[model samples]
Target: MNKTILLNNRPNGKPQESDFKFTDSDIPVVNNGEVLLKTKYVSVDPYMRGRMSDAESYIEPFQLNKPINSGIIAEVIESKNDSFTKGDFVSGMLDWKEQQTHNGKDLLKVDADKAPLSAYLGILGMTGLTAYHGLTEIGKPKEGETIVVSGAAGAVGSTVGQIGKILGCRVIGIAGSDEKVDMLKSKYGFDAAINYKTTEDMTKAIADATPKGVDVYYDNVGGTISDAVHANINRFGRIVVCGAISLYNSTSLPTGPRIEPILIKKSVLMQGFIVNNFSDKFPEGMDQLSQWLKAGKLDFSETIVEGFDNIPNAFLDLFEGKNKGKMIVKV
Candidate 1:
């Protein structure tokens, strides 16, 4: 029997464990051009939370009474496709089930010996690509520039900060907790880090870090922290609105410091982007990231929960800021 987590209903505000149900069914048979895969690791990203809602977005929302879809690293158990054979390792979008039979087109065989399989779901996966595109294409950090990134200890945020350091820029990170702030400075090599919870004045904290003002702001948690960053941006600064983790679970729209005046006065460019919009550039991003990972120039972390039943809890952790890096479920 293959166990799966099913969406019981659409979530209201924060998602509860009761919103999901665990079910079991027989392993599916592979069809032509399809492969059977045994789940190894399943990524629980913040974007998945948006999918739980029925609102319109770049991707289709998760339907009520269906298995939630996520990026998964798996081992091939059976293959009806010539492209893949038994015992191959792959990463792609797969159902949150113990075993999955799906079309092979979406699956990409991973070189396990080169990098940890879990990385294919993280640093070598969607999150890493997001950081790369947001930083290079959107933020456009220059040498000696001041770059500020909110949610700096999370998966995408961590990558952004480290990349900023590699580009010879002063990187300032803002996270939810002191420990995350420490990780940003110590492990990720961020020049400065601020814990939003500890700091009463966010704008002051940002100003203190970037005394010359920020050139690029890679925004992950959009709300007050973002507004604070906006308030201190230099002329012609760039803001990449990657993911708004703060507003994802809000029952109401959050109000923050008025930033339009700052934007107009500084001529700051603030743009929102979905990673999928840069699919054509993904291969180049992955290649560059892979080289950096192998050269020990980058670091990444994953807070993994064991068992498929923990999928809902893993997702709930994201909203609470309970996770340090990329949160994944090991099924």
Candidate 2:
């Protein structure tokens, strides 16, 4: 039987277990030019929260009763396509199902021997590509400059901080928990880390951390945290707007301090982007990330939840900030 998870309802605010439905169906059959895939790992991300809503966005919203898809790493258990063979591993945006079949279009073969299958969903996949492109293309940190990353302990944020350090920038990270903050500095080499949850004054904390001022702000969690960052932005600063997990679940439009004055005064460059924006340069990003990973200049972390039934819970955990780095479900 193939266990599939679908969008049961459009989440009213924060998603609940009731929003996802699990059903059993016959395993899919592979036709000529198709490969049968067995789910190995599933990635649960905060950006997916936007896709759950029916609002117009960069990507289409998930249709009700249809399979909810995200980044996935799967094994080719059976293959009728010459491009793939049994035991081959592939990574792509696949459905949240135990097993499925594909016609090999857009699917990229991955090697487990080089890195674990789950790595493709995080460091070696879209997550890493997002970090690489956003920082290099928009943030553009220079040597002796200061870089601040919101959601610093997440997959993309942590990698962004590491890359900043590699490029000779002083990096500061903001995370929810003290443990995550510590990981950012000690494990990922962030120069400083602030626990936004415990800090009384975010703006002051950011100011204190970066005495030189923030040249680049890699924003992942927008809201008041972003407002605080704007308070300390430097002249000609660059802001790479990524995910906004803090406001993803809000039923009403969020109100915050306007950034127009700050942007105009500082001549700051702010841009929002998704991984696909850098699709043409994925090979370049992958090469740099892999080289850094193999050379010990870069590292990654994962919170792996075991069991196919636990996928929804694992995804829900993202809003609670319960996972460090990448959150992946091992099926």
**Each candidate's root-mean-square deviation in Å?**
1.0, 0.7
Reference-based lDDT, each prediction = 0.91, 0.95
lDDT for each residue of candidate 2 in 1-331, tens digit (9 for 90 to 100):
8999999999989999999999999998789999999999999999999999999999999999999999999999999999989999999889999999999999999988999889999999999999999999899889999999999999999999999999999999999998998899899999999999999999999999999999999999999999999999999999999989999999999889989999999999999999898889999999999999999999999999999999999999999999999999999
Best by lDDT: 2
**TM-scores for every candidate against the unseen true structure:** 0.98, 0.99
| Over 4 Å off, model 2 | none
User: What value does the lDDT take at residue 139 in candidate 2?
Assistant: 92
**lDDT tens digits by residue: candidate 1, 1-331:** 8898889978888889988988989989889989889999989888888899988988999888899989999999999989999999999888888998878887899988998888998899999999999899999999999999999999999999999999999999999888898899999999999999989999998999999999999999998888888888999999999988888989887777777888899898999999988999999999999999989999999998998778889989888898888998887
Error of model 2, residue 86, in angstroms: 0.5
Q: How many clashes in each structure?
A: 0, 0
